[model samples]
Target: MSNTPLVQMIGIEKHFGGVRAVDHVSLDLYPGEVVGVLGHNGAGKSCLMRILAGAMLPNEGEIRVGGKTVTFADPNDAREAGIETIYQTLALADHLDAPSNLFLGRELKTRFGNLDDARMLEESRKVLARLNPNFKNLSDPVSSLSGGQRQVIAIARAIYFDTRVLIMDEPTAALGPSETAMVSDLIRQLRSEGIGILLVSHDMHDVFDLCDRVVVMNKGRLVGAHGIDEVTKDDVLSLIVKGELPADWSARNLEAAQ
Candidate 1:
């Protein structure tokens, strides 16, 4: 594996009318590492990730994957580049079964041009078994599944497509404790598989427990980046609320300031 990051968003900027939603934000994610993005509601973390996911374009910035600069014209371009985003909605068809939902737009077909249901189901089983061993209701409509099960399906779909960079937005927002733990375990599994993850979440517990690093933003500006061992929950909250670097982070920059 090379030292280059799996994905890099440099100097990203997004403006809406008179407001700069994201200003000169830069982030890097590496394989097998989960970097949690934290910010208040309007702090601009979502805007930056959206640009990286190809959901929205930035006014100024460049995205590089595998050390090659590329421009994403749309989400399809991002997916083709091995980037998969699992939004909070999960984006599944309620009436469809697991296999049908997994192969929603990109269905596999047989030589005769018919849908390859057997192959699709087999692949779905393999992926789901790896992600969620308890997910035995593959033939049931997603509407009948629990919140955690649905999340497993969403994640299984992403990994099934050979996803390299996975962006998960508020994955456990609506889950109970057990479901949250289930999703957290799946995230750890994905990280162990050498997938680069950009996790956007407001849950401090999730960030502290799951991420290797935390990147904070405030009012469209990058506040600071801290390794998991470098900051505490209070330190992160201070940064998010007041845009202040942690005391230790400030200490590291004292000589540079002088």
Candidate 2:
């Protein structure tokens, strides 16, 4: 992993009315690493990630990308900063074909200003070929495609725009074993390409299998963060449920032992 973080959220906090949806929290994602954010419903993990994705603003906090502080008024600003978010919905246009969906809002236009269908199709083919070689339904509407295939489209759209930081929310949820494995393989490929990923997932197996590190949150506060190899599933569960670490586990002891 790189010594310098690819993305950092420092002292992030979010509130909805009188409720503190996200308490002061700080997290970092490094290139070529996957950090899993695990929390129960209403635990504020999604709120924290939304702040980073620019879908929601933090009440107080700062975000740094590539070592420079930045602000995002909306998701477009985040995309401009090389950050892309893949929500659980995948957010593809069901009525459109792969090429059309790939460049939905940001379409390639001819010099004459018409939708450059041919060029868009060609570019979509190239990117899909890289992400999923078996993807051949370029002309069919995405609604007819399988779940795994839909995910490929969403991911291709993100990476095609030079995305460096990806926030994936419940990427494998509702996926069958085979489809889940496919998505996992794609995540590994993205990591190999040096794209930092913030994975928000509820599946313990997925977290253990795909994450380099895991952070737990409860009641809008970050309970603890642990390297995958340094913590057990039970330990993580305790943190999630009680917002407390194991009695023997402390940052000082872990550092000294390391």
Candidate 3:
């Protein structure tokens, strides 16, 4: 992994009237690393990610991409900065085919200002093949594809544009065992390609299996961040449920204090 982070969110804060949706949160995502964000429904993990994805603005914070401080007025700005977000919905047009959906808003056009369907299809095929070799339904509407296959389309769309940072929200939420495994393999493949990923999930198994590090949040506060080897599932669970560090970590802090 690179010593420098591909993306850094520093001291992020968001408020909704009297409620603190997010509170002074700082997080980093390094190239070729998968960092899992864990939290309950309102723990602010989603809120923080939305800020990074440019879906929401932070009341107090700054974001850095590729080591340069930047501002994102909208999601398009974030995408221009090489950040892409795959929401839980996958956000595909059910009626559109893979190629059409891949080039939805940013369609390829011919010299005369016509839709370059052939070129878009060819490019979509190549990206999908890279992500999933068995994805052969290029002409099929996305609604007809399976869950894992739909995920491939979503991912291919994101990475096809040279995405350096990917934020996946509950990637395997409703996937079956086999489909989930397929998504897991795709994530590993992306990591090997040096793409930094922020995986927001509630599944402990997925976190332990796919993430190099995990950050836990509760009641809009980050309670703990730990490397996979430095903590157990129970440790992470405790942090999520009670907002407390593991006993061993507490012991180490006590020793350091002395």
Q: Which candidate is the best by lDDT?
A: 2
lDDT-superior candidate, 1 or 3: 3
Sort every candidate by lDDT, greatest first.
2, 3, 1
TM-score: model 1 vs. ground truth: 0.90
lDDT of each: 0.88, 0.90, 0.90
| Residue-level lDDT tens digits of model 1 in 1-258 | 348899999999999998999999998999999999999988998788778888898999899999999999888889989999888788899999999999987899999999999999999999898877877998999999988889888878887888899999898887788878878987888889999998999999899999999999999999988888778788899989999866676675565457
- The per-candidate count of clashes, in order, stands at 0, 0, 0
Instruction: Tell how far residue 53 is off in model 3, in angstroms.
Output: 0.8
- Which ten contiguous residues of candidate 3 have the minimum total lDDT? 249-258
Better structure of 1 and 3 per TM-score:
3
lDDT tens readout by residue for model 3, 1-258: 879999999999999999998999999999999999999999999999899988899999899987899999898899889999888889999999999999887899999999999999999989898777888999999999998888878877887897899999998886778768878998898899999999999889999999999999899888898888777788889899989976687676557568
lDDT of 2 by residue, 134-170 (tens): 9899999999999888988887888889889999999
Worst 10 residues of 1 by lDDT: 249-258
Q: In model 2, how large is the Cα lDDT of residue 162?
A: 83
Residue 212 displacement (Å), model 1: 1.4
TM-score of each: 0.90, 0.91, 0.91
Worst 10 residues of 2 by lDDT: 248-257
